[model samples]
Target: MHLQKDTNPALNTVTAYGDDYIEINKTRHQRSIYFTPEGQIYDLGIQSPFDFTTELLQKITGVCAAAKSPMDFLDHAAPRFENPEQIEVLLIGTGKTQQLLPPELLHELLNARVGVEVMDSQAAARTYNILMSEGRRVVAALII
Candidate 1:
């Protein structure tokens, strides 16, 4: 991991493999994304306000709502899929509180042959980039 200062204060100064990660001095808003070379944001292309609602908000919320515990949001989010490896990392973001994912959900994923890795949304984003850079198949849900 490498860090580089950026001229733009709104952008993250740290660069991992020449990609931006953290952003400073700006209001944190929802639906905002920072991209990395390894991870191309996956747009499931779900339809309507449903897409934005789920991809941007509901998914995160659902994970938290289901967990009923304070855990890192990434713990609930979907996992990343890498080559030859079936384990997936799910990034759950807790906007203002700590939360945990329900055990049943994790089990469901595993039953489907997907490995689960949980992290906060920010870490998930960064990890997504890293996975993408590594040339893994990543699927993300986004509003059209």
Candidate 2:
């Protein structure tokens, strides 16, 4: 809500977003940072949001050229959890433009038992924060 640090430093929060930089937890980073409700933050490389995970954040590819479609990217990284089906929704931040997802992409997510929403990076960040604050099972794949 506020462009400031979290009341509790133990949690990771997005402080502000600039043209090509994002300030998270009071630290300005030009690179993307993957964070979870659990408050752990990791530097996300140039790879798409698919490569970042709550437990392990790794850059599997340089720029994800193999992903001809968004669905390919979405299915690229499936998190390791007790039950992957527990994740209710996935928020995808598509850089500066609002992305219109294809039916196949939606079908893929539905098949995975997860809902999907696509928005601009800023909205994605805000929504991800708010939903995460509410203790929802959410993951943000932000294209910063």
Candidate 3:
């Protein structure tokens, strides 16, 4: 699907998506990723939503290895924010299907007051554009 440009072109918007990848701001990402509307995109190397764990968050928090840069696979991307508290909402797109994350995996986010919504990648992409265009502090973690 191809999404029309929003009023806020500077923000990362899902221009198009498919069963295996999502295009953000005309850039194609084939791996799992999390991004804020303000243009922070973090590549989560896990192949499936089932592979998501607190360790991934740990990596972003500087407790583990660095995450891969979506822009350049050979380069490493440093963590921009310290924690999930930076965003008000978290959209978790569980690949081609909608799968609810186990509560244990979300305990950290809930404790940080981040509201999470689980859905399929397509729905997450649509919802992300709407929330982002509205200027809300939203982060989307999509497993492609």
Candidate 4:
């Protein structure tokens, strides 16, 4: 029932994630969430995560849809430099199951220089919070 508030203020932290929502700074969000570096939390229409660059977040929007295979979502994280290194890693939460990443999608991200990790939403939420606390350039596309 308590969120240990950190003295230093950063982007809101993921306190918890439930069946269909994510908690940030102790505020329980019961719907899909779209959070940018900016303070406000908007409805992503599917809810997703972090001081994350909006550019990166926007890029993720390009591939964040509910699909049986991640291939359904496209890779848009490639930067103009055309370096796949634009994003170091992307964490994907595939609902309640640990599904395989689409080959095409995985290939695109690898070619574009991004690493991908697939897990369930709960695990992803925990991982995301850990990475964010470490100040890594990480993002998550979550489904609850």
Top candidate, metric TM-score: 3
* C-alpha-based local distance difference test score of model 4: 0.57
Q: For each candidate, what TM-score against the reference? A: 0.37, 0.62, 0.76, 0.62
Which of 2 and 3 is the better model by lDDT?
3
Which window of 10 residues has the lowest lDDT sum in candidate 1? Answer: 17-26
Most accurate candidate by lDDT: 3
- CA lDDT for candidate 1: 0.36
Better of 1 and 3 by TM-score: 3
Task: Report the C-alpha lDDT of model 1 over 21-74, residue by residue, as the tens digit.
Answer: 233223222343432233333323333322233223323222222233345464
- In candidate 3, stretches whose alpha carbon ends up further than 4 angstroms from where it belongs are 6-9, 57-85
Segments in model 1 whose C-alpha atoms lie over 4 Å from true places: 1-29, 32-88, 96-98, 139-144
Better of 1 and 4 by lDDT: 4
Cα-based lDDT at residue 11, candidate 1? 30
lDDT for position 7 in model 4? 24
The residue-level lDDT of candidate 4 at 91 comes to 77
In terms of lDDT, the poorest run of 10 residues in model 3 is 59-68
Candidate 2 structure quality by residue, lDDT tens digits, 46-87? 445444343331121111112255465577864322333266
Q: What is the TM-score ranking, best to worst?
A: 3, 2, 4, 1
lDDT ranking from best candidate downward: 3, 2, 4, 1
- Report lDDT (CA) for all predictions: 0.36, 0.59, 0.75, 0.57
